[model samples]
Target: MMTAERHFLADDVPDRVRVGVADLAVATGETRVTTSGLGSCVGVAVADPESGVAGLAHVMLPDATGDDRGKPAKSVEAGVERLLAELEAAGGDPERAEAKLAGGSKMFDFSGVSEGVGERNVERTRTALGERDVPIVAEDVGGDYGRSVELIPETWTLTVTSTHKGAEEL
Candidate 1:
């Protein structure tokens, strides 16, 4: 893991390909992409099993609209697009991609709020993926907590971890 929140003292732990907040990455087999501190943020993982390629995105918002300020993965819409493009560039077929989603947790409570940012993130991600004709095969989303995630392309698994909840593979 490559985040300020967690560190491993053991040399046995595998080194990760870290995708920070508002970032995204595409990798082939034997590499895992990870992100931490998912509060009202989403981790979108896409895999092309036959091609042995995968992509992970740590999206912080719904849409970038006019400008992303140079951070392409800051929004779900742009993140999904960039992830697909990156994956395709790495020899992954976008037409054969399958998506898995994690995070999108409501870390804070606000009185009388109609909707949470977490929910919006999930919705936007679904919409973006759907528009691209990509199917979401798995999801772990929506709650009042924070989460960290790792996408292992070798296994086509997304390991979602939350302090309040135990870790699970999606």
Candidate 2:
């Protein structure tokens, strides 16, 4: 019986918040939202530089079938919508918002899986965002390694980090 582990930021970390898998976080000001160890999962971030409001969602699946209960951040469709709404509620202007995406890597090759989950996740994420008229400004997606991402709303920057590739800002 393996249980999910919840990691907390250090006491001195101030406004930095960590979002786990199948989770999302929204913040304003100089706060930074981060999520780690994203393989096939996708990290989607939306922010408004003028309002200083931003959000990050770690979506694990491409879409939600049947009943998804009430958690929207578990799938790309619901997750992107939920994040956009939250960002707006937090004072972000939808028209002025910019999105950044990262992760979604083919970390492994399965024997019988028809298509890679990473590709599907990326595609679905793009579709969802496009449907809502949110333009994706930057992306570091579709590769062979896992990545961690951080979003700074104040600066409207996304930093993607990988063990093999170091870090890049978008």
Candidate 3:
């Protein structure tokens, strides 16, 4: 008798990804990823429909201004710009690039500071996309629960899943 035993490695996993708050993801197929535990943080997903190139960013703050100069551009503006640059380098059409924004939930209690961050993130993301002239095809921002975002490059489809509520297609 022969027993079947197999172990799948990280590389064997589909193009799936897991992104944290204030973080971003960029790839050209060969991976399907997912992100979790996003509270008061915003997630940005960009993709070039024609080229099948896509990226995602989980952001915590708006612009890196106050006491955040030396650090990297984890803010909405900087992160999106970085994502776009990667897409462009991959031969993804700048004009054809479409963006999808998600997360930015109020996970804390009545803490004003915590609640405010999510709102600011949403606004900043919207503003940043506008400035770059990247059209937002879909979004799911501002809520009471954290979200998990999934991006499929081949289809240019982004799906957002929440903890309490059911999954919503964006």
TM-score result, candidate 2: 0.87
- TM-score for predicted model 3 compared with the true structure: 0.82
Candidate number of the best TM-score: 2
Q: List the residue pairs that clash in candidate 2.
A: none
lDDT of 1 by residue, 20-92 (tens): 8877877766676788888889999998889777878889888676776666688888889888888887778
The parts of candidate 3 lying over 4 Å away from their true place are: 1-14, 65-73
The candidate with the higher lDDT, 1 or 3, is: 1
Model 1: CA > 4 A from native: 1-15, 111-115
| TM-score, one value per model | 0.86, 0.87, 0.82
Worst 10 residues of 1 by lDDT: 1-10
Per-model CA lDDT versus the true structure = 0.81, 0.81, 0.70
Task: Give candidate 2's total backbone clashes.
Answer: 0
Full candidate order by TM-score, most accurate first: 2, 1, 3
